[model samples]
Target: MTSPLANPLNRRLLGASALALVLSASGQAFAQTTPQTDETDDATTQLSLGKIVVSAGVEKIATDTPQAVTVLNQDDIDDTQASTIGDLLDDVPGVYTAGGASNLGQTFNIRGMTSNRGEVLMLVDGVENYFEGYRMGAFFSEPELYKRVEVLRGPSSSTLYGSGALAGVINFTTKDASDFLTGDDRFALRTRFGYESNGDGKLGSIIMATRPTEDVDLLIALNGRTSDDYEDGNGDVVTPSDASANSVLAKARYYIGGDRKHSVWASAQVWESDSYQLYDQITGFTAFGTVRRRTRDEAFAVGYDNSFEGNDLLDLKAQVSVSETLTDQDGIALASSLGYASEYSYSTVQARLENTSKFTLSPDWTAFVTAGLQYYSQERRNPRYKADGSPLSNGATTHPEGDTTRYGGFVQAEILWRDKLVITPGLRIDHTELSPGAGVVVGGGSTAVPEDATNTGYSPKLAVLYNLTDYLNVFGSVAHTERMPILDEVYSRSGTAPVNLNLDPEKSDNYELGASLTLRGLATSSDRLNAKLTAFNNTVENLITSASATSGYFINVGEAKYEGFEVEAEYATRSLFARASYATVDATNETTGVLLNTRPADELNLNLGYVLNSLDLTVGWRGEFVSGITNYNATTGAVSSTVDSYNVHDLYATWRPRSGSLAGMDVRVSVDNVLDDYVKNNLASFAGQGRSFKLSLGKTF
Candidate 1:
């Protein structure tokens, strides 16, 4: 008989078990030795779960919100040391990365919804940000630029976000000068440096914040990243993996008006990446060859906010913004044969105005109502050039140029009946117009004369929450939303196929129910636990099919349904803490009885940490377990293949001196994939990164 310690699998299992047992024993031992009282260490509390969410058109605690949501703050961002945006969000339930593992290749997948299909919406500082291209990710930005990230799951958010939000919304808020200004300090400077061993990656960032006047603050940030090719768990090098990026952020805020209740702000951001990589960023190795690709994203926004303290019916907020995203590719190795060097870009101008009113009806009843109007104009252009740098008379029909303008208005009311019951109702309506760009041509070399299209969409939702007990609560919601057809789907043509001008809007009906449990001093006098379980089912009609080289575009066919459940729990004490998130999602194409390819396998993430208050240090262990998934052909209902399940573990530590000469210094170290497991997610085209040792140092002045 072989010794269990001699087997690699057994070794990993033993490691995991040992870690869990050590954490449990330590926690119990600490509880026994430490003083048992009603008071607990403030630093040991779970702050992530108590975060406030604003993406739902109002401010509510994560546990108090009726819908499913997640919030990651600055501390969480720094601890992850994520290289790509995907890595930063992988721990969230019902959220994962799809496409590839590269910085420019990864995209977000929520439930079974993908950004490529226009199901997901993303925002940076309340400004829309997105780009869609063949085999390319939709949103790209540096993770270091943000101080907070909020994820709102499900289509129920469509009422406030927009009518086409089939998947969910992701909001990123950048750091502000006020965030760094401590006490009466008028200026602050922060610098950070980081390194990763696996890919030999390096990061350098710096920020300067200042209060130039009594009522004005300004901030500027610059960040740069560079990384070389990395090897997989099997010691295979993924080619064309080298990448680099640089970005800048600048913003300012000024307070005006009596009592300083009014304020105005402006911000500008730019992110650019230039790399020589494969044309199809989604796949590492492809026969399409490589190109010199440069991608840039620019955004500018100005806004005004007024609290109107004494006025019950006058709280206003307004904003205007412009954003542009461009991806230019040239020097294509196969351009001579393919006859195309592409330039894809999207330009958008948007404005919004909103107001909130509060009313007190009786001592037990109070209501808050919010209404808003939004307008945006967007243009998508994809131009092609020959190998000699000459413009082509007719561009590729797979991606047609078009303009879209939308006007929308929405109203939502939140009514509270004491602290026991809450009701929320919302409605949104949008009108959109689409027009084809100049020099449009079809696949057969004929000048295409496509007709303009106009459409209207509506979203309605209702949600209720009831506190059955002080320690337990139940919530439920129902929503219906309509998604208008995108330019690519309605205007794209191929082979002998013509433009699809009659594509109907996609409609989604969503239902969600959940419960939460709050427990204090369960095992020890100072321990706390907060847990939530959510179950959701969504049905989408008029699912659009993508066009092929020989097929026309935007054909609305059958229905697609998705059902899932999520569990989020946190436990903490003075010296020990544990957090876990588990998700199970299943989706199918009702028309063909085939599982949706975008569906991810059930996953569970566990994290446990121990704090050494005397040393100002915290150490933690994390384990991620994913289940196997079976793939099937959409049309034929044939088994394609299966992805095997895998488990990966990580170890991390952080130290920040509070009362010493190094008080302003912060240090972090992490060992990712401690076992070097060859992990593969169902939505990914490549295996996950191999074992890596990461370290970072930051200091404030």
Candidate 2:
């Protein structure tokens, strides 16, 4: 008889478990046994306006940072009742989702730049999530698995995050055992079940956490979901949209050294999905048939963090991670006994190390410096198979079997003057090399030799913030960023072999100005108001764009420009809260004097909520609006289409008992698209979901 772990999938799980054990053992051997104080606890206890560690320079309070940043806590995540990444980001200003309904093709558009070609960088716990190939998606993880999400807008992030962040960065921080074991309990368990009417979706999740000792903690979670095809506003079923997904996550942490100054952690997550998409048959081609698609994604990471007790100069953090995404497509011709299959795989491995130091320049002035190094590599491969499970001799992969390697180093400094003024400056340099494999075939049925290219980039950023009063601050920033061409842009084949090996790196100059105000006791003794306004101008040179619709090659567009403004405000009291945000962008191709394709339209979001503490009940309402947008023709550079503007509304309520037989239990209900309004996204090809209701129940012990 064989053990259950003997199976391949179980073996992988056991391997991840063993790796966590090894990390724990190593931390215990190198660290001194002492009671550890969790830094996250201290951070959580601070007011919302306190220091933020996700900024460009050293950690600083929100009022001191010169960029537009948004932080969403767990409570915000729960209130939205989101089923996909797009749903989760709908309310964020200056950001838009491009794909329709499916998780496999979704991408983000930030400011006037988009991630369709990997302009925006996605990070999970400081580890890079690489996207490659045409059908690839962003890092999609279960919302319940995260504690918070931080979005940094603009190109200044290049100094800290390196390449692929020409637009900005989105970072996700996962939950830990301490998040669930809030009290003195040694063990805790949480279970959740939810349903959505639009897709007839049902979901179940379980989380378990344990603190075996004062210095060790462990957490494990599993989630599963299944959904059917959903209906549009017109009461028509969205074809081939059914799906089933599952995710597994495990994390471990060990605290070592005196006063818990040293810490080590390891985390592993695996997500898999099976879904179908409709492919209409060609008018004259009998072999064309509907296709079925399946996708699987997995990510794993390990990290170490340490802080010195007696010294303020040597805090260290390091991480290494690897991720892979695989997609398979099968097509069967309904009119004949014919079938075909193809597979695509993308993978990445990355590592990072950083050290931070702080010094007291004077009684009222302090300074900090951060320096880091990063390295990563990515590879993509595609293979085609015949209906009889045999290989096609003439078949060729898309984008080539190539890999990209990047190495970078950066340093940033933050200085305070008289505790009323702050200045931040940073610089980064990166070297990248792209190597393609041999035996590649071009579109014209000719073999092309592989080519290698190397490029370098320099990024510089400076920002300043001045406190005008106790409740008001003004800030400004200017930065220069450069992006090297990605694999697909340079290696994608055209007729016979027109490889672009001499393409120059795209360059951008960005400028921003913003202000923030925090007012306490605005109307009542406990009322608070926070507001922010920001404006930006960005110009890009040597923009890489496709040459023509018929040509697969890429060329450098002369220039492009993006200008935008954003406004956000929130007012909160003991029992009531209200918030609103608006963003507008004007983007154009400078050389052609025409609007960019699929440019994001003006957006507005508003929310209001009230809590009845006495009854343990809460109710809220949310609204979103997007203006009409114009689309441009790729070859003719003319207006080809327009998407009409639309509006959506949602309502939600929650009941949780603080102290009773139902204590530690919560029930939530929501109605989305309350009016059953017909709506279409500015960039998506399909219509948005119609009126729907959601219900969720959860309990913790």
Q: Which candidate number maximizes lDDT?
A: 1
**Model 2 quality (TM-score):** 0.88
Q: Residue 365 lDDT in model 2?
A: 87
lDDT of candidate 1 over 1-701, digit per residue (tens): 12233333453454345435434543454323332112224633544565678878668777778988999988899999999999899888889888756687457889988877668888887666765567677787898999999999988778777888888988899999988997788999999999999889999999999998778989999999999988777778776777799999999999996565799999999989998777766644477777777989889999999988899998999999999889888876666544568788899999999999999998999999999999989988877789777887334566678898999999999999998998999999989898887555544344558888788999999999898766567999999998888777777776566677778899999999987655555567767666677789999998888744343555887999999878787778777888887777789999888998889877778899998989989999998878777888888889887877788889999999998699989999999999888878888867888899999999999
- Residue 226, candidate 1: alpha-carbon lDDT: 91
| lDDT per model vs. reference | 0.81, 0.73
- Candidate 2 segments whose C-alpha is farther than 4 A from its true place: 1-57, 278-290, 332-339, 393-398, 441-448, 548-552
lDDT for model 1: 0.81
Minimal lDDT window, size 10, model 2: 30-39
Q: Candidate 1: list runs displaced more than 4 Å.
A: 1-44, 257-260, 283-285, 333-340, 442-446, 547-552
As for candidate 1, its clashing pairs are none
Cα misplacement distance, residue 217 of candidate 2 (Å): 0.7
How many residue pairs clash in each candidate at the backbone level?
0, 1
